[model samples]
Target: MSANARTVHPLGERLGKVLPPLMVLGVVVAVWWAVVVKTESAIFPTPWQVVTGAMELVEDGTLWEHIRASLFRVGAGFGLAVLVGIPLGLWMGWVGAAYRTFNPIFQMLRPISPIAWIPVAILWFGVGEVSPIFLIFISSVFPLIVQTTSGVHTIDRRYLRAAANFGVPRSVLFRQVVIPAVLPEIIVGMRIGIGVAWLVVVAAEMIALRSGLGYLIMDSRNAGNRYDLVIAAMIIIGTIGLMLDGITRLLEKLKTVRWRYVR
Candidate 1:
């Protein structure tokens, strides 16, 4: 293709990605507004009402506080999950005995809903920030451990065999090859973990804490049916969740990990 064509093509691709979503969002909002108007919703909020509600929160300074609290909790919990899970997963993946011992326990715990642990979290950590952080860690860490372990299992045997043939030290082989090879999978796990963590933190905040977006929704509801604020909180939660996912996706573009992300 010509240079101009190449330039135009990428611009087209970007627009292709962005425009459809924008169009769909517009249609959804239009329909939402129309429905609210027709139904004369005493409780349901129109798009503009949600916007106004958001602005009200912004004006009162509570919006940033709630957003900051939620982000901080997610960051802390997800950080802990990464630190604990990745190393544990790598060890379990490499050592047969470790895998045999730990796999059953994690598998048993994995299927339980994080929400179900709210009582236990509250009991263990009390109704404080630690409760939600602990829940987020619990919710996020499992997927990372599972994914990283699976990644190690699936690493090409030839890589290991070739490293062995070359007399590469066990430590060097693990550091240079195993870690790099497993990074893509680690990123995948992180993506899943972060999403779950965000969800868990919000839920924990709603039930146990006073300061996150989740609490904003619950609080808005109780304060004379402020459904607009409720919807605004919901939208903020969703938008931030998407942004977190996108940030995780950017890690896939790292040179060492990019090879595994085949189209």
Candidate 2:
């Protein structure tokens, strides 16, 4: 293709990728506006009202504060889960004895809702910031552990045999073979964990803490029945969650991690 054709091709592809989502978003908003107007809903917010409410918070400088608080909690909690969960999962997956001993326990704990722990969190951590952080950790950690363990279990046995035939040290084999092989799944786990962390933090903020988007939402409701602010907060939460998942996805592009994805 000519240089001009090449440039136009990519530009056209970019627009093609972008326009469909924009078009759908437009349709959704048009319907939302129509329903609010047709029903003469006083409590439900129109899209414009939600935008205005968000702008009000923006002007007051509270929007960024709440966003930052929520992001920080998710970062801390998800970071801790990564630090603890991945290694534990690796160990459990590599060692049959460890898996046998702990798998049942985690399986039981994983089924319980993180929200169900709010009362216990308040009792133990006492309505402090730590309560929400703990909840985020709880909500986020299990998926990482499960996914990482599965990743290890699914490693090709031929790779292990080849390493053994080469007299590769166990540590070297783990570093060069096992870790790289599992990275895609680790990224997947991180994506899931971070999403859960974000959800837990919001719910935790709603009940136990007094800052973040969740608190902004609750405060807006209790103070003035501001459904617009509530909707805006919900939108912000979803947008941030999508952004976080996208960031985790970018890790799959790493040279070491790309094989599983590209193939």
Measured against the true structure, the TM-scores of the candidates, in listed sequence, are 0.96, 0.96
CA deviation > 4 Å runs, candidate 1? 1-8
Q: Point out where model 2 deviates above 4 Å.
A: 1-8
- Structural RMSD, model 1: 1.5
Q: Candidate 1 at residue 45, lDDT?
A: 92
lDDT of 2 at 158: 97
Across 226-259, the per-residue lDDT of candidate 1 in tens digits comes to 9999999999999999999999999998999888
In model 1, pairs of residues that clash are none
Measured with C-alpha atoms, the lDDT of residue 1 in candidate 1 is: 79
Summing lDDT over every window of 10 consecutive residues in candidate 1, give the lowest-scoring window.
1-10
Per-structure clash totals for the candidates: 0, 0
